[model samples]
Target: MNFCKRTDLILVLITAVVTTSILGFALSNQVVAQINGTQQQNQMDYTGFHSNIEQIIAHLEKAEYNKFFNNNTLTLGHALHPIEEVLTLVTIPLSTADSNLNDTYFKDLYQLSALASPGNSTVDEFDNKSKSSIELSNEVVATVIPATVLSTTEHNVSVIKDLLTISGSEYKEGVAGGNIILELEYQDGSAFMDRAYTLFNNTQNISNDTQSVTKLLSDFSNLTDSVQSLKEPAVIDQIIQKMNIGLSPNDNSTTSDVSSSQTSQDYIDTIRGLLNEVITAYESNDKIKAKELTTIAYLDNFEYIEASIGKELSDRGEALLREKLREQIDGNASIDEIKQNIADINKVLDDSAGFLDSNPK
Candidate 1:
């Protein structure tokens, strides 16, 4: 009986030892599998985090390219769609305990965000290119259509007026009309430049007054100089700087000073009065009053500029007006004929101003 009992106890001890060893081996394997799975998950998360930032940047670049160069409306819409997805993906890793991973992801996120917003130099180029495209498109349309249709069409006028109203309201509320006038002045100045070359070449044969020819040549030279100056990168930079300073909410202090100098309530009132006169003259068939009012209205805005440049611009405008008036008097002397001339000149002036007024710079 003693031998049997001893043998039974030894068997029980061996069985207990075997069972504990098996359980340890099983537990070790499970821990190893869990660690491997966790590592794979971390690697995937890191990959996804980087991919999200890249996608965000890619979309933003596409939007900018579409806006400035391609003008691909469809691509622009496509580009914005991924922004929300990127934002969501970027936030996923933020909840993780890894500080290094979070910092890396956030850095890329910030850069992408900056690229998407205005004020970055890239955005300025994009804005300028887009604006130039719109201007060029408008010019092409203007050449194909009559000035009457260009100025009076409700659709065209309303769109332009709304844009002007928005720009003015956002930047210089209550002086939307002044913005219109300033634009007119620039347009008149541009038209005068276009005619200068022809006028200069023809003046030698047409005019006996050497002084007038000399003055015309000098004016042409000055206008050419101004055009060249406008093309310079520095000048463009200055204009952009001024626009940013004037338009940015953060730069209100500087903008207020510039605004006070460039625009005023009186200027706005004068432009409004001029617009009314133009509309009335066009509708009433008053040729003389229309031409005179157009000239006066354009000149009024020059008062806001420096004395020298303003006077030069004003003189150039006056000379052009005189030439147009002379042509009208010679070709047709009847009252009806004169009315038509006035209407035509007014229409041209209005169209020229309308283009500039719609575009601030």
Candidate 2:
């Protein structure tokens, strides 16, 4: 009996060891399979992240290029700005994944998407200015010089057109990536926005005159028409007509006083006073001041005509006239242009002779 019990106990111990080995092997295999699955998941996640980054980089490039006249001689001297092309590429190890990269990359994708405006985009302005410069140059070349010897002609022509034609070849000659004066995206860090807004606003700023000047012009236009109906000074009447009041040869100003039911004699006096000074400048042979005042007068009156009677002449009126005045005031006016303008004014004045005797307020 004692021998039988000892054998049974040894058999039980052997079975227990076998069962433990089998369970341990199964557990070890399960751990290895789990580890392999995790590695595969990490690789897929890395690939997806990389793809997202690539898409973002692509969109940023597209938006940036749209914001400029690329490789423009008048604009930045570069095939592309660094902000448009350069991106900081990141490679994350499997042991380390960066959360900041994920957040920033996604945000960039949203901003550079086509759904956003990018604000004050230079795309239209640059395209128009650059293309218009070329087209206008071609037109002037055709109009001013015949097909006969246009290549050898030496006639002075459109100021902007000449600048564009001479500089057309310069667009392709710059470094591939030059220094960027403006950034490629929206920015609130400064008064001026980045590349997009900076470039579009630059050309417009040069053309924008002050509100005070614009208002003074409106006042003068109204006063000239009022002075015409009264019979006092022939010289003043001629001056009123010569100023191009309401853009008519006859002085007929657009009245804004219909709502208020009062005509302004003060505006008349102010306009008369300014003309009095202009007359003095012309009479004293101060060509510079006369030209300056004439430039202001032309532009101001033109703005009035543009605001009032210029809807019909929208395509033809005031544009070239304003540009000419801008050139005169900004010192780009040629001596010939200035002399011609003065001669036109003098012609009108000469038509109404003996005007000094009929002058009294």
Candidate 3:
């Protein structure tokens, strides 16, 4: 009876050891899986961000093309529309990734936008600024997105399709009643098409679907001409159908959800920080730095929330404040004058902040 009891005790101990080992292995595997899942999600996010950067570069090029090649300032301004839409998505993630880079990036982007404006910048100035923005965009993609996850074809396809859909919708809105009723909308639609085609051409060069890609390229060429000629909405729709595309139901919001992505206080804080920097620059007699910082303050931060702030303060009111600050910095106003300008701007920001607080999105 003593020997039997000894054998049974050994068996029980062995069973417990095996059970613990199995559980340990299972738990470790679960942990690894969770980590992988997280990495994949992060990759997806960065991939989408990278795509937006590419589109921005494309739109900037198209904007230049319209301004110089086509001599169409209106189309150039319209190109800024999509850039504005994507810049909103770019700002927060970019700020999170690298704050200094974000500031410089927006400075260049704002410069580019200003240069691209009608009768605002010469060809040389626009060319230089657009080139700078494009280079920065490339750098951004390299910095933000990992090399291993660069060529996710499905995500690229989805993004292209979304741009195409947006293009079609914008075109339809612009050409109601078989007429170009809304010129800005029509120009914006053309801009979207330019972006969509740019993306498609890049993707097609690497894509394996030769037959479909070729067909789509042909359709895009036709669609571009049709859009430019102010064809009826139905013509655009039929061409879109031939492309066999659909807007991404799940991921489309990533581009246009800029306004809701951050709170009013967030923008206000950014504006305040830039304003403070402007003051520091001014105190040091760095007029160039002061003016540059001031431009960034309005273009990068204030412009982001101008529409929202306009609800609380009239657009003209905010514009006057911005102009006052710029004028002070440019005219070499006293430090007190600059501070007062900043104070006025802050008062308007404060009012907008309160309004946003009372009615949060």
Candidate 4:
């Protein structure tokens, strides 16, 4: 009897140990999965940082155009002032990922800012700083994102078209009768064309036909000189229209509509940022500030793009979100409720983006 009892106890002990080990394995895996999920989210956040950097570069290029054409130092500073703030936002996440990379980025950013100060830095100095900053950003891109997903050729050309269209519009606003009437507007228009030219050259190697690419390059060269001479902006438009036919023979979207797609994206990004601020403010118990931000977001940003948003898709969605956000704020909604509402708003915006991207009108 004693031997049988000892055997039963030993069996029970072994079974318990096995069950505990199995549970431990599952728990460990769960922890690891959670950590991996957080890492992926961090990576996605970095992708957004990369996009914001690209927008800043656009501003920088525009500033460069102003300086190169008319020595407009004021525009140079105004354009670049946003860089520091953007960098400040990314500092913590960047530090968490790689301290060295964060350090290098900020160093380059500060130097660029110093060199770009109005009435201080020459175009050559600013150019060098810009190059360094751009190269550093490229390094960040290589480290953070796979090359295959960097950017598609179609997306590149779409961006090129937007730049070109905006260039034509700006030129029209700045010049009349082969003379620059508005220096600032003309400089902005010329700057956009310069940017488009650079981007077009970069896309050449990926293009299937070398001859057509060369022809486009020659046309761009001629257009550049014509722009300098303050020729009719319609000529620029004509060249862009020809390029568009080659790009999308079936698509009938106007150049302005195509350009509005980009503008719409910009507005959405801004609205998202403001909504984030609203959450932060409300959570901190600053209802007044939160309500004010909510108002500014809709009135200042969304209102401007309201017409451009697809009439069928956004007519109710945006207004509904605007109203719901206000209701949540006024009712003293919980933090989670506010966040959930913001998420819903983001989903609506995403749908709007899809519609705009595909329809482009």
Candidate 5:
């Protein structure tokens, strides 16, 4: 249920909070009064937006908790929708002068919120708008390259080149082409390199921590075994690749393809639905129906991983035991037996982490 580092997403959110710092800038009483008919209602709306932001935060936290167990994005997106609405409803106070500059971000969020998902287009739009506002200028255009980013990111290269051309400047060493001049920050590479190194190390350490994985597994069911030993090397590599995407600077292949037909959230809902169906079949004493639900929902998902483990009594074995035990429960196995089977599976999963450690990818 781990999510890769979402630096870009977090940046979008963080900037939105203080983006309206211009609201506190010089506002005439007339402008303020014209914007809000009543001072009391204005105060109320301000207070309400604050409360709404908090409520949205609660939604994200709850969604994250669900994701920790289920790895469901649908659940997360469902929660994000409310906050998106709140961001939309927050109108900019009607200050005609400099309002376009001030309201640029609020305007952006209005569109971002309406999207079914703030997919790549919305995210890129927001990023570009936010960046251009702070850095770009029609009068003063220059090519500024960081040593680290120049080696990668073809898009950024085109962007800088376009800025140079638009400025109508010809370059000959320090001689400017029109108004465009190349201004390079020669020492900027150190800070970016340090940040990249730190991110990689921190992510690797967290993913490799046996205790943390075991603790996470413990929460699913109190199966007490060290989890580092049970870790899957391929899975670990997948995780590392996901986490290191932007941070690595040169790792173009870090991104995963969305090949699973169902969205993460949809997949989760299907599993949950099957679990409910299994419960219903068990309650009705329909052994065949219960097995059908369990096999389709859980067993099929694990079948690929089972073969990958390549061991007799590894994670796969424990999973098979749990699946069979669940079927046995439908056929009148005792509750204690069910618990025992789960515990056994937990131990096996935990030990498999060690096997993963020994066999590195």
Candidate 6:
């Protein structure tokens, strides 16, 4: 009986140990399966995230290239669409078995996107286009503006010239007849002036008295000869000096003072007065006075006057004035009619001048 009882106790102990061992093994296997399943899910998530990011990048590159090709001008505004989309994709929660892997993936995507987007080129292109547009606009202005102002100036000059010829012829037609002085002066002044003066003079000589014409011609010839002999280079030198002074990059205060002193309103007014005097001398039948005034006026204010008018007017105005002159010559408009037309045009220009002063470029 004692031996049987001991054997029974041993059997119970063995059974208990076997049961515990089996439970432990099962629990260990279950834990390992759960870990493996989680890892597989994480791998799948990573692969999807990476693939989506690549698609976003591809779209951005395409958009950027499209904009670049279309306008030949790049800008950040163009990239806004692509960048917003990329950020949305990057911010989405990505599953990763390791937290560190998720952080690294996001960080790299952000950096790469930034690198691929246009930055300096966009800024530079905007700046360049703006500057170019401004420059072209300035060119057009430079061409058109000066010509407009100079038209009035040239008309005023032509009026004075015509009056001089008429008066000079009346006083001494013998001197005025073959007088090429007016022709020379007009030719040197402007092509329009030359053509107009030649046409007018030729027409007048055809009907005028021969002796009077001869006298006027001789006097004008002598006058021109005297001018040629003077040989004074002072006027040209003054112009060069003034130009040099104006162009110097001095302080604004000094430049303002110099330009003001050099460009006195009185100088401009004096030229206008001199031009009027030339007309007065002619209408009064005083060839001597007309010739004297012409010499003095040419010496005192011609260069300054011409320079001022030239600077104020632009190339486009010059072209338009030429066109108008051609039309007038072809139509055979009288001098008085032409003068009235000029006055009307000048009124318009004066209004424009006022506008320009009020609203500076």
Cα lDDT listed for each candidate: 0.35, 0.28, 0.58, 0.57, 0.33, 0.32
What TM-scores do the predictions have? Answer: 0.19, 0.20, 0.51, 0.48, 0.22, 0.20
Off by over 4 Å in 4: 1-75, 78-107, 118-127, 140-145, 169-173, 176-182, 204-206, 232-235, 249-257, 260-361
Candidate 4 per-residue lDDT, tens place, 1-361, comes to: 0001112343344334323322232111111110101112313443334433443465566666556665555344424333322343344344445657866775565555555545557878777667666777667655644466556665556556656765676576667788877665576567667766776776644367777676777778887888887788777677766765545445577444544345777778877887888888787775644655665566435644554564554555554455577656656679899898888778878887887788785
lDDT of 2 by residue, 1-361 (tens): 0001112343344334323322222111111110101112223222222222222222233333444634222122111111111111121221023334423332332222212232323566444443433343233234322344333212111121112111111111111133222232111111111211222222222223466335435534443333323323333223333322222223233111121122122222232343344456545544334433443333223222222222333223333233333234234345556555544443333322223224321
Per-residue lDDT tens digits of candidate 3, residues 1-361? 0001112343344334323322222111111110101121222365446546765766777667677765554535534543334554455455555656866776666556555545667877777777777888888876655565555656666556555554665566567666887665576567767766766666534455667566666777898888877788778867765554422323444332332344567767877877787799789875544554565455435655654554347364345445567556545589998898788888888888877777675
Candidate with best lDDT: 3
**lDDT measured at residue 11 in model 3 versus the true structure, 0 to 100:** 30
Tens digits of lDDT, candidate 5, 133-243 = 224211011112233433333423222222211111111111122221222110111112222232223232333457644443332222111112222323323333333
Give the local distance difference test score of model 3. Answer: 0.58
Scored by TM-score, the top model is 3
Candidate 2 global CA lDDT score:
0.28
Better of 5 and 6 by lDDT: 5
Each prediction's total of clashing residue pairs, residues at least 3 apart in sequence or on different chains, is 0, 1, 0, 0, 17, 29
Rank candidates by lDDT, best first: 3, 4, 1, 5, 6, 2
RMSD of each: 34.8, 37.1, 22.3, 19.2, 24.5, 43.3
Q: Clashing pairs in model 2?
A: 183-195
- Candidate 4 TM-score, C-alpha based: 0.48
The per-residue C-alpha lDDT of model 1 at residue 40 equals 19
Candidate 3 residue spans exceeding 4 A from truth: 1-51, 69-84, 116-120, 204-209, 241-361
Candidate 2 wrongly placed segments (more than 4 Å): 1-279, 311-361
Say which prediction, candidate 2 or candidate 4, comes out ahead on TM-score: 4
Tens digits of per-residue lDDT for model 6, 122-191 = 5345344334433432332233224443234333222323332222221221112234333222222222
138-232, model 1: which lDDT tens digit per residue? 33333333455444323232222222211222122111222322322232233323322432353224345566556645644653454334443
Model 5 RMSD to the real structure? 24.5
List where candidate 5 sits over 4 angstroms from the true fold.
Answer: 1-290, 314-319
